[model samples]
Target: MKLVAGNMLWTNINKIPNQYNYLNESITCDVLVIGGGISGAIAAYYLTKSGVNTVLVDKNIIGYGSTSGSTSILQYEIDTDLHGLISMIGEKKGVKSFELCKEAVYDIEKIINDLEDDCDFSLTECFYYATKASMVSSLKKEFDARKKHGFHVEFLDKKDAQKRFSFPVEGGIYSKFGAAQIDPYRFTHALIAKAVKNKLKVYENTEITNIYPKEEHVLLETKNHFNIQAKKVIIATGYEGRKYIKEKIVHLLRTFTLVTKPVKNFNGWFHQCIIRDNNDPYTYLRITGDKRIIIGGEDEKVGGINSKMSNLSNDDLVSNKKYELLLNRLKSYFPEIKDIAPEYQFSGLFGVTKDGLPYIGEYKDFPNCYFSLGYGANGILYSILGGQLLRDSILGKDRPELELFRFNR
Candidate 1:
């Protein structure tokens, strides 16, 4: 699959800080992690830190997959709203999912601080606004659902929202201290570098062609005929990991993003909080450390690269058109910002599950193999949870939270 295309902001902004060698001969490890994006990096970091002999490999350079295209908006709020999730999986499991994600945000902060390099990590506030007046009631219900669970949130009416932000919304949920942002590309490389110093083996430009799960261990064969023997394997391959699962748990969604040149002033935007709306295919905006505004949305189901889903009317939904639409929406939201244009724009494929939670445990059929598929808008945060849970699982410890994200569930 073409995971990403167009000029990516992260890859164009920063180059890889460290490099690794490709596999030249046969190798063996206690655990093997495939795909060197943020997911694989997280798995390797936790496993190696726990004294597990681990090896990580990527077909291309690290962070070049979905990580590069990622907007990297870290939030506890899943793509499924709290109210919807409660309806889907009951109140207890639904709230627990958010709690796990909220914890992951801080855990990620700790990981970034522990590393030698700073990846532009910052704590921020998030606003879930209702764009249209019709959505106000349900949005209020969402706010209540969150508050009922003891989350720190404020219900904002139209007047309250306009008082803070320049854009006027009908109403919204204002959440504080449960969101963050980061340079995923830098974070990935920095993590792998630190893990390497602690005995984590990393191989780049090495593609694993076939995976064989045996009685005691798993053997991975590379395209160049090199074999990797491991007691366990982690398929942190993101959306591409779909090839291994029989059931269609993850549906690939095509999303667009536009990053603007740094603006001189953020006049109307208050606190530069991450802004998202209640639209089905919602529009979201975030401010980068460099003062650039990233406006992203317009999700479409992909039938293929050139083909759209049966619903989309236009066959020519090209990048340029999407970029213009995004820019127009930005102007509509915050008319105060001026003379700003996208410095970079791109699209990428990401996996989303029906219930808006990631699949992060061992599949029964693939014994001794774990899958760390963080499939949703909160992929980075879930990757943190995945790393923690998989670490505990490998150490032969039991976690009740693991059942919530199990493959069978």
Candidate 2:
């Protein structure tokens, strides 16, 4: 799949600063991770830390795939709201899901600290607001549900919201202490660099064309006619790994984003909190470390329902139009920020599961292999949780909580 297209801002701001060679010959390892993006890097880091011999391979340069295009908003909220999730899968499981995601945010922070690398990580609050007056009651219900569950949150009415921000919202949930932002491209490189220092072999520009699983081990054949043999394999290839699953669980959706020129004043914006709306195709706003505003959303089925959107030809023109719409939305929300024009813009595919939970465990058909598919807005956080869960599973200490993300579920 063409995971992303057009100009990507993250890659423009950071360089790998280190490089690894492509796979040229056959090799063996305890674990072979396919796809050296954020998910693969996290898996490799944890696997190697547990004294397991691990190797990671990528079709393109490390972190240049969907990870480069990721907005990297680490929020506990999923594409499905809390109330909606409860309606789908009982209250106990729904609450557990949110709690796990909330835990993953801090776990990621700890991983960054353990690596001792600078990845532009920061903790921030979020404002999930209603876009229209009609949506106000639903927003209040969501706020009440969360607060009743003892989560850190506050409900803001239109008057309070307008007094604190440049824009006016009918109502919203002000979540405290459970969201974050990071430079995903930089974090991927930093983790891989640290993993390399600890004997994690990384190969770039190496594509796995075929996988043959044996009774004991799996054999992976590369595009260059080389082979990789491992006791177990991890498919961290994001949406591209959907081919391995017979069950149609995730729907691929293309989302667009634009980054504006740096702004000197954020006077009306409250604490520069991350902002999103209650629309079906909600727009999300965040501030970059360099003070640029990133506005993303306006999602349509990749190809408008049936066709392959990735195969479309006029991607550049479509990206421009999406950027224009995103800018208009941003201005409508915060008209006080003037002279802002997008310096970079891009679109990429993200998988949305029916329950908004990622698939993290092994599948029956694919023996001796684990699938770490982080499919939602909180993909980064899910990857962190998947990495730890899979590490434990491989070590013969599988936790029962992993059942929440089992494939058959």
Candidate 3:
């Protein structure tokens, strides 16, 4: 479980035009968004589309934060198992929360289609397979819960699953709906582009240093000593919001991924479906359009950083060793592919909440401030839903989903 700390997939997408200069003068907007990752960008996009004057600022280059590190498997299936969720939050709330995630996947597809974003978006079925005999009962229980909650799922035997997908598995649960894969960078860039085209102000490389709530508005201070005043402020700064949330439950964990050179025999090994193992340090595999196999997993908590020597530079042997292990695992699972050497290896960190659900909605103490954090693996979908929810709340409209994702709930 060596953790890597870079994003290879997002680094290849088109870059958005950046405004590197820091905010030097005070400005006013209907809404101010912090963090330029997928969540912030989508929030600005939705707010602007609603004709709300919006300003978005990021500490670094837009999409360079946790969004870039995402494996981008846009599925409603969360890091927490359904049975666990039901046990923790009662069946009614648990089922409702799961429905929100299910809706998020469909909502994202509609957004991409309606906007006609050229983000390499594709419809794909996501599969969760059991890698050990001990996991079979849990998998079945999850599958049954999904079915009871009205999700489209099918349980498959090892032979049937192996016949359809080349990956090694003991058994699996396939959900035909509520899943997709997209180039996250392209998606973020597209949203920012559209938001800019609609006259939303996006300031990249403009880091916010502090935020203070005013009588009727929120005041944001930046590293360069610039101030911004907005009626509503949204913090989508990912794990960096630890200071504001003041909760250690938002733990940071790193995950590694490797993309191999395009293989002609990819069809024999994969069928464009997203695959994940039902294990702790679970492995997820997907085939890109160019037939490159993208294998991701090997996650470790941030405290485990020393175990893998990830602190070493990119060309150092420590880095090579991490990638080597990932490649070896890929070969072990899909032995039919030759030349399994990876073309690229990268890693990134994400924040996880104690309850394993993203923190969304407004801060109880500060009415004008909204927070979106702790989207462990489903950041893309949550960002979309969060953006819409934040916008609705800011405009004084009712959003029923807010109850489940609120920060102080």
Candidate 4:
């Protein structure tokens, strides 16, 4: 699949800051991570740091896949609301999932600090507001649920929200902790660089076409006919990893994003906090370190498992109309930021599970293999959490929390 193809904001700014040689001959390792995006990079970081001989390969340039098109808004909040998740999986496990995500944000912070390159990572508050009055009550319930679980959150009314945002908010939940932003393209490269220094082998332009799982080990074949033997494998291919699983567990949703030119002043964007609404097919807004405005939303479902998704939409008319709608939404939100327009707009495919958590453990049939599919809006955060679990699992230690995100769950 053509994972991404567009004038991506992050990749465009970085200009392919890093590169690695592709696989040419057969190799062997303790672990093989397929996909060189943020998830693969994170998993490689953990394994290499722990002294595991690991190899990572990607079909395209590292981080140029969906990671380049990522909005990179890290939040403890899942795409599913706490109340809804509780109904789906019960309170204890549901709350645990949210808490894991919360800790993942700090874990990511620590990783960046250790690397000495934060990748434009910043801790910020997240404002999940309701656009219409009908959403206010559910918003309140969400606030109460979060507060009851000891999260740092505040209930905001219309008047209170209006005070912080340029446009009026019906009501919302203000998350005071565990939300952040980062440049994913740079972050992915940073992790791979650090991992290479720690002795991880990486290859690009290498596509794995076949998997042969044996009783003792697994053999993988690249498109070039090279063979790789490993004790274990990590399928961190993001949305594209769906091809490996037989059962349907996720829906592929296409999302659009628009990034505007730097504005003179942020005007009413309150501390440059992340802004997301409670509407169906919700929209999110964040400001980059360079002060460019990013507004992402407008989700649509793929027609089938084989449906093609490119970073640039094939239909110019549809893509233009979508981009126009996103720009107009931003203008409406902050009319004070005059003469602002998006210089970058792109589309990418991401997966969403029913319970709003990522798949992060061994699948039933994929013996000697684990998947780190960090789908949904919390992709980066989930990747951080998944990486740690994968490392532990590979090291012969199992985490009970992993059951919460089991493929059959």
The sequence of per-residue lDDT tens digits that candidate 1 reaches over residues 347-386 is 8886689999999998878988999999999999999999
Q: Identify the superior model by lDDT, candidate 1 or candidate 2.
A: 1
Better by TM-score, candidate 3 or 1: 1
**Ranked by TM-score, top first:** 4, 2, 1, 3
Off by over 4 Å in 1: 304-317
Q: List the residue pairs that clash in candidate 1.
A: none
Query: How far is 160's C-alpha from truth in model 4 (Å)?
Result: 1.0
| lDDT by residue for model 3 (1-409), tens | 2223543666664555444455657799888888887888888888888898988888778787767766788888888877788888788878877788888887777778656475777778888999888888889899899888888999998888778776667788887888888877777777877888788887877888778887799888888888898888989887677678654556666677888888877544445678889888888888766677888877656664464433534565655676788898888877777767677778766567766788888665666788877467777777887888888888889588777777655
Tens-place lDDT per residue, model 4, 35-89, is 9999999999999999999999999889988898899999999999998999899
Which regions of candidate 3 are displaced past 4 Å? 1-7, 13-22, 267-270, 304-318
Clashes of each: 0, 0, 1, 1
The residue-by-residue lDDT of candidate 2 on 282-389, one tens digit each, is 889899888999989977676533456764332567666878898887887777877687788888887789999999989888899999999989999999988999
In order, the Cα lDDT scores of the candidates are 0.89, 0.88, 0.77, 0.89
TM-score for model 2? Answer: 0.97
Our model 2 lands, by Cα RMSD against the true structure, at: 1.6
Candidate 3 residue 86 C-alpha distance from true site, Å: 1.1
Minimal lDDT window, size 10, model 2? 305-314
Local error of candidate 3 at residue 260 (angstroms): 1.4
